[model samples]
Target: MQRYFVAPEQFRGVIITITGEDAHHAARVMRMKPDDQIIVCDGVSRSVRAVVLEASPQEIRAEAEEELLQDSEPAWSITIAQGLPKADKMELVIQKGTEIGASSFVPFESERVIVQYDGKKEAKRIERWSKIAKEAAEQAHRHRIPSIQPVQSWRQMLTLIGEFDLALFCYEREGAAAHGKGIANAVRQWKLEREKSSDEVVQNPRIVLLVGPEGGFSEREAVEAEAAGAILVGLGKRILRTETAGLVGLTCLLYESGAMEGA
Candidate 1:
């Protein structure tokens, strides 16, 4: 069945009214008609299996048959703070990151970043990224779409680091153990500690993964990041590309947190 995300207002007492882009896709693109079955999600944690009652260019209304059980969302709300890379690399990251179970994304500027922020194009850029996230979520059968935050400056991004339960700063260079450890080992230890501290699962725990641009973070930036309560970490033996490192780290984080396996 085709899946569409609806607003809280769109679904009322088992009536799911999909409007705007979803309606256009259902009506014109998919050629959906009355009696067609579909699944509608509220983009948080709730989803309903419904049968289409009416389809038009502006609206497609459906009647809920039963509430669908959804647990696809991860226990941790992971956000990827990517240092703005060149070209469409950020698009690839956001699309794949959403599929990999990221809760949101933050594109920020770093000392080594090449792409300068375009204030005039920022709105359109973010709009495009948001669309990518939504389409990816639907294709991935995700209950919620990942949020794309406004691009932040280096200092501004640093100020937001302490907000997360754990922040892993991705550094390509292999440094002393004091600097960092293998991502798998680090995240596993963190998870173990969390479980030991509280027997109950900590759902919705906030985690932020930071990956620098082409040349990676400078020594000064590294020291500042650690000072801001972020753990400097390496992906593995080989140095991954700017866009790939964060995805790999995110997968490691989610898997270690028991999200990849199941609820």
Candidate 2:
């Protein structure tokens, strides 16, 4: 079934009015007719199994048949605090990160970052990244769309680390432990600890994963991240590009957290 996101205000009683670009796509591009079954998710995460009742040039109306659970979301919220990379790599990060169930993205300016977003350019960049996130969410059938927050400095990123239960800093040169211990091991450990104490599941655990820029973080920056309570971990022996590292880490994290597994 085809799926699209709608605003909460568009939902009145059992009827949902899909407007804007999506309406155009349905009415013109897809050429959807009346009685066609489709899925409509509110940007906030609520979804409904709907069937088209009316289709017009500017709008498409559907009747809600059943409320759908957002099972694709991970049990824990994972936020990627990535150091801004060069060129259009941010766009790729936003798209793939959303598909892997990242709750949010924070683009940080690190000491080693070569490209910087300043003044009006930052606003424009954020706007573009937000649109990419939305489109990616729709394409991935995600109930909730992940947000691309404004760029932050390395210091500011440190301040925001405390908001999460666990903060992991991916470093290629870290000597703390071998990268062989995959993300699954970390999640299993956390889960086991929680399960031993209580039968209740810890839903919505917050995890923040940090990835450095193209040149990677300086030694001082890595030290500062650790001081901010981030655990420095290696991805593997092979060095990954700034664009590939964060998404790869996030995918493993989500899989370990049970967000990517079939229910």
Candidate 3:
């Protein structure tokens, strides 16, 4: 069945009103008709199994048959604190990250990062990235859309260290011990802790994964990140490009954390 995202206000009882671009897509692109079944996510908590009851040029109304579980979110929230990369790599990062269940992204300017973000350019870049995240969320059938935040400086990134339960910073220049205990080890530690907890309610773990720019992090920057409470970890033996490193790290994190399971 086809799925569409709507606002919570658009749903009143069992009836859901879809307007704007979604309405146009239903009426023109998809050529949907009354009695056709579809899934409608309210972009909040509610997702319903709905069937079209009315279809017009300007709007499409569907009646809710049953409320369904939201399938777009992952079990754990993963936030990527990526150092700004040059060129259009940020666009690909935001789009693919959303599809893979990243809850939020923060692009920071690191010592080794060459791409500088002035106020105006930062605003424009964020706006474009936000649109990409939204579209990717829709295509991925996510219950909630991830946000692409404005670029932050190194100092700003430091202040956010305590916000997450698990924080890992990928450092290519780190010593051999860092390379030995990869992302898999960190994930295993978190899982073991969770299993050992005596509390009945499972605590939702928030992880902050940091990735550096094209030239990677400076030694001073890596030291500062470590001091700020981010555990410097390694990906593998080979060096990965700035664009490729973050995604690979995230993929491993998600799979290991079990966030990529059913959802």
lDDT of 3 by residue, 162-189 (tens): 7888888888864245445677776787
Error of 1 at 95 (Å): 0.4
* Clash numbers, per candidate: 0, 0, 2
- Model 3 gets an lDDT of 0.83
The alpha-carbon RMSD values of the candidates against the true structure, listed in the order shown, are 2.2, 2.5, 2.6
Better of 1 and 3 by TM-score: 1
Model 3 TM: 0.88
Candidate 1 Cα errors over 4 Å, as ranges:
175-180, 195-201
Tens-digit lDDT track of model 2 for 103-199: 8999999888898577678888888888888888888888888878888887799999987888888888852355444455655776788778756
lDDT, candidate 3, residue 179? Answer: 43
Query: What would you estimate as the lDDT of candidate 1?
Result: 0.89
Candidate 2: list runs displaced more than 4 Å: 175-201
lDDT tens digits, residues 1-263, model 1? Answer: 89898778887898889989889999999999999999899997689889999999899989999888888888789999999999999999999999999999999998999987798999999999999999999999999999999999999999999999889888766433445587777677777888888567666789999999988899899999989998888887677889998899899888887887833
- Clashes by residue pair, model 3: 72-142, 72-143
lDDT accuracy of residue 39 in candidate 3: 87
- Rank the candidate models, highest TM-score first: 1, 2, 3
